[model samples]
Target: MIHFDMSIFIVAAFLVFTLLVGICFSRQKTTFREYAVGNKQFTTATLVFTVLATLYGGGGLVRNVEYVYRIGLWWIVIMLLSSFGLWAVGRLALRMGPFMQHFSMAETIGNILW
Candidate 1:
């Protein structure tokens, strides 16, 4: 009598499925512009939310809450200072908006260099 672990079979099946999907959907030749920005136009609010989500995703919110509970309320002041830094960055980004017509920092730098 032989015993097989069904979990291994399930894991292998999932990996194979994911690989097949990647191969089917991936482009053979992707331009840098397309790869970087997907040639998509996003509204200001959408871009803001996307940035916020990236910053706070992956247990960041939970970890911050835990730190507040263990460390004290002063952690919130630090968070606010970090947010002020983000505000400064936003101002710089706005100033650079004209130079980023292609929406890629590398492209803008290359153009400036050459």
Candidate 2:
């Protein structure tokens, strides 16, 4: 007599379903630009939301909360300063956007230097 775990079957089914979905939705032909940056048609609001989600997603929110609990309100000031630094870097990136047409950071740095 063999005992089988039902949860294993559920997980296997989910993995198969996810693989099928990915195969069905994947593009057949994709350029480097398209693969790297998508269509580049995102609106300002969409880009803003995406950036915000990336910044606050994963364990970042949890880590920040833990820091605040452990270290008091100064963590918030550190967060604000970090956000300001990010904003400044974003502005600098925008100014260098023209040099990044190929989406290569190395090329952009070379262009800036020379």
Best by lDDT: 2
lDDT of 2: 0.85
Q: Model 2 off-target regions past 4 Å?
A: 1-7, 107-114
lDDT of 1 by residue, 28-109 (tens): 7787777777776678899889998999996999999999998777898888788988888888878775685666668788
In the range 1-114, model 2's lDDT, one tens digit per residue, is 889999999999999999998898785778878888886878999999999898899799899999999988899888888888897988888876476575777777777788
lDDT of 1 at 82: 85
| Residue pairs clashing, model 1 | none
**Residue pair clashes in candidate 2:** none
Window of ten residues with lowest summed lDDT in model 2? 95-104
